[model samples]
Target: MLSKIHNGVPFKYLIASFQHQPRPTFPRTSPLPLRSRPIRTFSVQSILRLPDSKAQTGSRHKFTYDAAASFSAKHKDFNAATHVFHFNPYNRIQTQKRPKSKRPASGQDAFFISRVGESNAVAFGIADGVGGWEDSGVDPADFSHSFCDYMASAAYEHKPDAGDPTLTARSLMQRGFDDVCRDGSIHAGGSTASIAIASEDGMLEVANLGDSGFVHLRLNAVHSYSEPQTHAFNTPYQLSIVPASMLARAAVFGGAQLCDYPRDADVTQHTLKHGDILIFASDGVWDNLFNQDVLRLASRRMVSLGAWKTSDGGILVADDLKPFTQSLAEDSAQRSSTLQSVIATDIAAAAKTASKDRRSDGPFAKEVQKYYPEEDWHGGKVDDICVIVVIVSEEGKQQAIKSKL
Candidate 1:
């Protein structure tokens, strides 16, 4: 048996691998009609897999500056330019999900971070391949990675009109899915996608399908969240559960018919404020950690950080954060690794306590009951967990202001 962390917590890992079979040709999906749609904007707060335990210091944090997409031009009333964003992402393969035989490892979870086009706007997302596709002789990871790549492209190509982000995001899923099926490189496997786009105008648009989700925080408290679209407990809506067709669609499981419709997504918009943070995660993180736990854990880290940047250029630690991170670096080979360890330990502890407490019927109890109904439920639920944290700092806000001037 293997052990791993879900939602920054420790849990028993379950291993399973998909044997790669020859890719078969499938009918290509026709492009969905492009139409402008109106999206509701809520007056509210805004809001990684680790390749390694340590932060990768090789590259500068990818922040693209596009001169044409200034915040002032988009919305002249607010003298702010696009929000300059920074992010930290972490990913780990679940030991339980590994195949015992000697085979190339396939990870179904994929995360992406990039600057949207020439704009200072940032985009981040996570895609989880449906585990059910393993039995169909297809690898979900391929689908997930390809889908996320398209999402990043969609973000870059997006041109919002009338301050409406609906059409921009809708086009990404519609066209991206078509390209994914048209290309012969990727297999016909289904997956779930959760995407967050922080526009140059400081407005946020999050679009999602299935269980992957995100939480938004203002200072230490949660301001909003992207709701998970699950048919039932443990059964999430995915791109395409059936391998017969290469369409990107989702439906309720348990005797429900699935389709290839690309528009089956839940999209929401939010107006962000300074000092806001957004956490995008797969089901693994949401199932194990409740909203409050996420809040508590993040708030705790914010304190431990004692005013620091989570990602500097490409390095996880910046000069100003050296003193605060020095203690963490001493404990582990990398400061990011140490931070991951601490967050995981804290989340696991929270899950344990929440399971026993019947007072609140939240995600913890539901997760334990859903995943471990047959056995004694202890600790957190076992699943592949990935988390991406993005902060909109005072400095970032100031930079946005300067860009407009």
Candidate 2:
């Protein structure tokens, strides 16, 4: 169903209660409404190898889409890519001390590719399945991946107008939820969703379900960001709290199922300009690193790789992006950094903090063990982590300038 949000409405906290199911329980917190203060808002061949960095482990996949290449072949306007997209997705099952004989199923984080039906405009989303669903005898990763697939398809099907990104995000989530519900394999599972759509016009639309969120970086500072919906620490809002019929199942968790999920996502809009960077991540990253740390890590990479200099610390546009965008200048700063750099940096940060010894058998370690007792958490809280960084490509910006002429 299409849920409406009155612009400028004061933020309202809508807590959903879930019944226990013999698993971890989250506090009773309604889905954090997307606050309106938002005046804001792959290498093939190079394809098969993972990074050799100490920070990045687990399974990694990277892809780069250039509009000047295949995408532009279709639309003449795309002769120069209006934007370039790079993604580095990684996953690792929580490490176990004794380690399960058979890697206990799979890590529950899932990412969706946002391209379909002939336009360079695309969207990206990540879903992290709630650990509580393991009790249902179902692999929660299946649900998380399924939700992403459906959401991407829905975005393609509805094709919201370019100017109306808010609707584009909302429609994608609402319709994606409806599609998932139609399938019976996923009877009861929960996940957090953070998605963003960038159009040819340089407009970005974002939506968050639960604690998943995105942060905008410009001029070495976080210019704007999303507020996570959560009942307490570690428990963010989720798409599926519980089934309407089996609300009693959540009893063991202390919270009762309060509302249907996949409803209208807290949608926000932003006019993306050159030199802006957007970081979309799951709670695993935010919970572990401070906002400044996140930015510092990214900035450090940009500088070390020569993508940006300390004096002008803006995002770097890829050097050879002529394949991605048509009007890219030969002399502009070439991006030497890869999505792997950012993803690996985040995973390393989380691992370091989670593994940091308090010098005492602190309560933090106990909290980490309490949740993932079987896994060798390596002094770090063991949870699935995902990060996606989007930067305005130099070629795309040059194209924008040319178009204005």
Candidate 3:
């Protein structure tokens, strides 16, 4: 499903299920929204209070940020000026009926980050939540926060900085992951990691712990930057955390197991250009659409990237980003609400789609229906349709230069 379309035509990589029904008068919701939406924002204190590995075992640190001094140094003025827009239209399959369980963060998915000491550049990331029959006070979003912050701390504490910033970025992710996994406090489930780092010197690096991946959309081409694999094995030792069945499902698509964390995709010295977009996408969006499809939609408009500027003396807060992205789902309704900013979403929220379940009878086997299922992506385990797109302008422009006629 991750194929980019050129002029509304499907490419080889894009496998159109051929399961779409006639356009209905009402809106339809599915794994793909062909649109994006806004997400909730976490305060700086929330980010700071996250647990570092040492604290995971037992450190009494409540996991909160100190409000006195500022740790973020004007992230709005940043040179990258990357505008990110994303929506998880098919997030239901990932959510659960939430209840108290064996582990915290059972069914909560969050996008967390931790920056280096003085560098505005990020150092780590965490996502995915698991909750259901398996395991409550702890949300997966919480793990994402602590895990990312700690990763940055661990990397800075390295014996000595590696000469190459890119290598250092990679080392930071690898070692930090090891630290999180070693802790006895955290439990394992559906949670996954797709982390990355960019140093002040212009080096980029990323690593993922599951099928989720990153996309780099240049002016014309879209590049994938994550490897899909898991820790599943017939050997008893592998059963320590991740189950063999889960691992087998991951490997069904030919998974990889490298260095310490299953597998990863990296770049030694990837140089970025102006108008370039680097997206850290969850499976909800990536699994349903190809990377090129993203580029196609993004290239059509000049997204407001006020959030990525860190040099203009403005700090790109999550609030600054929410509106720009939320606009992707314009709603013509609710025009009087002062709180409403952008209206880019469709009017209807639900629709009756088609399914091929009736045509197939695989003897109760694989059940390959060879068709699409009817569903809505608005508020359940799959609640909340989302798509995050980050647009970066080399020229660093959110304003247009009007010419005198």
lDDT of 3 by residue, 203-273 (tens): 45665655444666553456435444432210000111343544565456544322233244333345454
Error of 3 at 202 (Å): 3.3
Top candidate on lDDT is: 2
Model 2 regions lying over 4 Å from their true place? 1-106, 156-167, 241-245, 248-255, 258-260, 312-380, 394-405
Say which candidate scores most in TM-score. Answer: 2
Candidate 3's TM-score reads: 0.43
**Model 2 Cα lDDT, one tens digit per residue, 231-299:** 443456677735665655445445565233655467888876555566776655554455666677756
Report backbone clashes per prediction.
21, 31, 53
Worst 10 residues of 3 by lDDT: 346-355
Please give the CA lDDT of all the candidate structures. Answer: 0.48, 0.49, 0.32
Q: What tens digits encode model 1's per-residue C-alpha lDDT throughout 30-149? A: 332221111100000111211221222232232221111000111112211121112222111122212224211224666666555444566777777765555566767767767666
Candidate order by decreasing lDDT: 2, 1, 3
lDDT, candidate 1, equals: 0.48
The TM-scores, one per candidate, come to 0.58, 0.62, 0.43
Worst 10 residues of 1 by lDDT: 36-45
